[model samples]
Target: MPHSERPSKRLAVVTGANAGLGFETARGLVYQNYRVVIAARSEHKGRAAVEALLKDCPEADVRFEALDLSRLASVRDFAAALRERETALDVLVNNAGIMALPQRELTEEGFERQLGVNYLGHFLLTSELLPLLTAAGAPRVVQLSSLAHRGGRIDFDDLQGEKGYDPWRAYRQSKLAMLLFSQALQQHSDAESWGLDSLAAHPGLARTALFEHGVRSRALVGALFRLTLPIMTQSAAEGARPILHAATASDFRPGDYFGPGGFAETRGAPERARMSATACDAALAERLWQVSCELTGAMWREETTT
Candidate 1:
């Protein structure tokens, strides 16, 4: 089905909308006439992003809300605030994430920074907002994943990176966990009849600021990224296309993965991409779900039980 024909009575919340792909995704949704709330950690950045959107799309109903995905308490606060203001939510873009930070850090909640922010925070936020999403008809949750997931593995023993931490490895594992969470969410939602569509998307190798956050050698990384970026990277706007398609496209299905259709799935138009074998492991997904509930204390509503 064409995007124009998709249902429009939807409210969308996109995390990390201050810049890069998140900003682009919000812009696309606003262009489609959706009431969008851009969630960011910094109030200044959030307000600036919303103002920028308004500059381009004067009719855009975009607003900024504070949300620090690394902290579970902040996630709860944001969710509670949203619940108080909105009766229903049609779309959630779990698009905010950190990548390749050189330092090994933990969130305020004490989980590995990458895992907490990239996966668990979204996990809790989504569960908390499930009721609002259920109130809307055919709501969708789009999780931003990464091609680096191909090299990821869930280290049950070192989920917090206690054993060791490599920035890239940690990021990859967190993204892998995100894919697993999206698949598990689809399964549970279907069995329990929640009527929510959970899909995952990757931006491929888009040249975004994700790598500049904590690199020890920013100049070298930036130079290398620029050198290879032409071959591997896509514009942030183009990188956001799959996410918009997954959230707004009619044919999107639960558990479906989307990404670039180009070389190494790096830089091209959006397409339904293949998930790694680990991402499709139901048993692992279920275990991860259970662990997530324990770690984040994110309880599912009765409606989410299979």
Candidate 2:
């Protein structure tokens, strides 16, 4: 249990907080005095992460909760348990994700693996937790997008990648969906007066386990990526800066996207990142939102949007 549960302290839930960028983000939040819930799939990893967090900050208010984003039931169960314990949720960083799989895969629900874990799971999780988010006077939700989104296109006809599949293509599409969802959610918040702030951010080539997990060792592409990674990429702690900024900064507007500000957006400090024309397409965003509701059976305001 966290040492302090002061009412004045804001509570934050960071998905994938067991390691990498998510862990760094959680640490940053704790430093700022926010009580954090480290959401992850593995109990061992989650508990170890909590202990590591305490080791760094003995007074830190942080704990682990089981949340496997690969399964919809787990997402719901995680949210339900959280709602039972906390009346309001101040921040939600949809940071959990898996990278490119060498072979195409599907989630238990039969959705494309990348799309299922990266976008759909977070979409449903956000929907289920909307009530708690709204209960707070002002709440923020941050979606982790990627530079890969620039190369992504929403292939509605092959969203599940059943017709054809390319590892990087599927991964790109999922990230693009995340960016689109972030915008659409902000628009809905504005139109419906939900009083929620929705934002998106990218890490700009952060050095993390994602590269190791996503790429094949013998693959030439993976080799090249690794060779250039140290030169082009920043550390995971640096990567989490933009996400933290979006989650806690007072000057950001709803729907703003942030990333590293150095050359090519590879490193430095937080700055407004560029958005692809497709990412800025309002019509495309709305269409994707409707499709996501249908895919996940996630209802907004107790009802799915048409």
Candidate 3:
């Protein structure tokens, strides 16, 4: 429990905060004197997470907000509701995402589930909350990409994974999109004098429930994940460090990407991580930004101060 729930304690929003690295991220922020909102897809899980967090940080100011990123409508609803209650948003951790699903699925909005939830959803959320972020004076937005983004390419032609779906490719592309999005938004912020800092991070190989989805049908993989998880992957607490660092670091840089400093970025302390060249294509990022605005009807151009 915090000794003081100071009025004007910094506020943060952590998506997927109900579990895994997101849970650890939220916990660490609470320790750092943040009043956090745990955004989850399930109200039940969201409330439960707040209850559990209260056990450790009894004075931590935290609450649950239902956020189903898979659907644009849900994103809109969440944003509108958020605006009603809060005028300032200090930190936004876009931490919610799914890894490899054996079969491809689409959101009700009919976009590939991975790209929809991982990249597009956060895109809209960030844009919608841009005003509140600006009101906070200097806000940080952290987009959680992946080491997988190193090998990812955005197939703009098959954005929805309609031609043929490989779960890893879809997941990778979404992560790549995240990096590109972060970089592009930062560029816009600098050009427009938005005073918003946008950054990216990866957890490397953190042992989390996210793996359960990938290993469900493959007995061999499941066994490997179970047996080697502890040995190969870092704990969720370790994974959250990069995120918490990006959110609160004093020397933070816009468009900076952070991850593990160890071998292949698998596990260790935080550092400036690698990213794919494809993630740097300005033309591609502009196209993706436009596509995201069209898909979500977020209309971020209207938010420009200039």
**Which structure is stronger by lDDT: 2 or 3?**
2
- Ranking the candidates on lDDT from highest down gives 2, 3, 1
Per-candidate Cα RMSD to the true structure, in Å, reads 4.5, 3.2, 3.8
What root-mean-square deviation over C-alphas does model 1 reach? 4.5
TM-score for each of the candidates: 0.93, 0.95, 0.93
Runs in model 1 deviating more than 4 A are 1-9, 212-224, 302-306
The ten-residue window of minimal lDDT in model 1 covers 1-10
Give per-residue CA lDDT, model 2, range 196-302, as digits (tens).
99999999888889956676633887788778887788999999999999999998989999999998998879999999999999999999999999989888762
Worst 10 residues of 2 by lDDT: 1-10
| Best model number under lDDT | 2
Clashes of 2: 0
Residues 220-255, model 1: lDDT tens digits: 766777678677778888889888889888876678
